[model samples]
Target: MSLPELLLAGFLLLSVLGALLLSLPIAAEQPLNWHQALFTATSAVTVTGLGVVDTSSLSLFGQLVVLGLIQVGGLGFMTCAAMMMVLLGMRLPLYQKRLISESLEHTSFAELAQMVRLVVGFALATELAGTLLLSLVWMPEHGVAAGLWISAFHAISAFNNAGFSLWPDSLAREVADPLVNGVISLLFIVGGLGFVVIAELANWRPGRGLSLHARITLHASGGLILAAMACVLLFEWDNPATLGGLEGLGAKLQAAWFQAVTPRTAGFNTLDIGAMTTPSALLTMLWMFIGAGSGSTASGIKVTTFMVLLLVARAFLKGQARPVAFGRSLSARTVMEAVAVALAGMLLVFGCLLALTITEPGQDFLGLAFESVSAFATVGLSRGVTAELSASGQLVLIATMLLGRVGPISLGYLLATRKTESLRFAEGRVHVG
Candidate 1:
């Protein structure tokens, strides 16, 4: 099978396996029907945190299963499979190399296995740090055992960008708590930077700088995060239901910061997302659609894609021959691939929204659009429409989640296609609007 097909099949199989396990009576505190199990499993496998059922209601075993699913999902099944292969002293085939190359957004596979090893170790170390830091806050409040569990779970979820919270309101109690807010926002930020960028940055010296791709990803991601934060703070500065509900400037700013970054595909909400102002919600939708870096746990068109489009637009205005960034000219193929990825993402969200319009005619366009973008981006930040949706709507989201996880990779494959020319064709010109 092609890379796209393989990815689709593998993710589907994992989702089904997860669903079957979650459906077991031992998995949940209450009986879990097939639909609920399937939806939860799909969400977990996709690393999208949208949940129809509250995660706190699940038994320990079920939560563990979800955590395991998030780890594998965040790391990509093919990466895990490659790790096992490396452990067994097996060499990767051409196909495996290609998959890893594309999935990790690496230009080549010279150090592929080494990079994968670093990825695993980095994830383990980061999650451990987050767990310990979070334990400091929750252990005092929830008691040692429960606090430890919550810390570990949140660390994993936050690092994976899974956004699954055992608490019903999702860290709402800790909006003003600096420890919880800081650690989580940082975790997701690193998680969403893409493993390749992390690995490269880890080995860097101050004067040595970094590669073009790494630089672009970092600069663009940082800019977007700051921009999103500013927008949210401005739009929600006086919304009584959101930022305004807090006590003081310190708490409000902290809440604003957390809420701002969450929509960068983190999904955890410090504020009541449903009660957010229309402008704030719309700004969040835009940030969620922009999403995190490629090969990261968080998903959307990706930071690189967003940057490429901006560069392309700038080049167009300047009448340049090609899109250039960081003093390097990007090939036409790369720009086209970026365009395809963004276009595919938009189409997927729009198609899901259209279907949802039929399945849920009661909700307004903004709510459904937010939900659709959230699902399609795998951001998992919903606006209270998820729980109220019908079974059909849930299925629509399931498909959308799968598409979110698989769609960009598939589009990547599509963009890689090279059509050989047997003869030259006449030049055709079209009018611009």
Candidate 2:
């Protein structure tokens, strides 16, 4: 099958699995329908945090099912399948290799199998370290087993940028807990940093330098995170509803930092997101739209795409013919693709927002728009509008989440695979402004 077909099939299979799991007697009390199961499955698989139902209410088995889906989704279905195939002594076909490469966002097929192994190993190591640190923080309050489970679940969720929380209010209730907030934020930052960059950094030699892709990913990601932190701090510094009323400097700083980092496709939030002012909410919407790196579990158009678009704008302002970044020239195709993706993403968000406005007429426009963008980008931050959305609004969000996770461009590619013939027509020029 083609890459698009493979992805769609994988999504469908995972959705079916979730539905089946939810149908089991132990999992049936909170019985999920096809739409809910499909939405949750896609959200987990895409590492998107938009959920039609509260995860905390699910039974242990159901929660485990969600966790399992997250694990498979974070690694990509094809990668897991490829590994299984290898274990069975089955050689990967060229098409399968290509599908895996695209799924992992790798540029080439060379050493892909080895890369998959490294990816899984590195993911586990990071998740384990995060879990250990989190467990230390949670053990005193919740005791050993409960703390361990919370730690492990959160570690996986944070590292995967999946945002599946055991608590209904998410990490908001633990905002004052420095250890919990700090550890979770650290995990989120590490996870949001693309896997390729991590792998490259791990294998880096003293004299050797980072690859171009690694440098771009790191620099762009760092710049965005720092900017987001500054923006959120400045915007919410005096807002009594958010960071203003806090007496302790440490708590305010921790909350600000956590909020800043989490919006970049990490769904955990220390502050009550719904209480933020219009300006802060707008800033968050922009951050959510930009999101994390390409190959990471984090979604959105990606930091690289945002950077490329900025470079393109800069080139135009400077009267340059080509866009350049990090001492390297960007190709025309790259710029075009970036523009297309951004435009498509914006349109999707706006479209969903419009749908939401009609469905949830009483909702705040700004908050609804922010929620729509968050869902479309798979960033999962909300202005407390998600739980309050009507059934139609929920359906709109579900579609947006799926489109965001699968990607608008990928969906377009899937829908129209046949290339149109370019028959040369009579050349004509029209006068323009």
lDDT of 1 by residue, 286-380 (tens): 89898998888989999899999999999999999998888899998889888888889989999999999999999888989999999998888
TM-score of 2: 0.92
Q: What lDDT, from 0 to 1, does candidate 2 have?
A: 0.80
Candidate 1 Cα deviation (angstroms), residue 171: 1.0
Clashing pairs in 2: none
Where is the poorest 10-residue window by lDDT in model 1?
412-421
Clash count, predicted structure 2: 0
TM-score, every prediction: 0.97, 0.92
Instruction: Give the runs in model 2 whose Cα sits over 4 Å from its true position.
Output: 23-25, 28-38, 408-433
Clashing pairs in 1: none
Q: By summed lDDT, which 10 consecutive residues of candidate 2 come out lowest?
A: 408-417
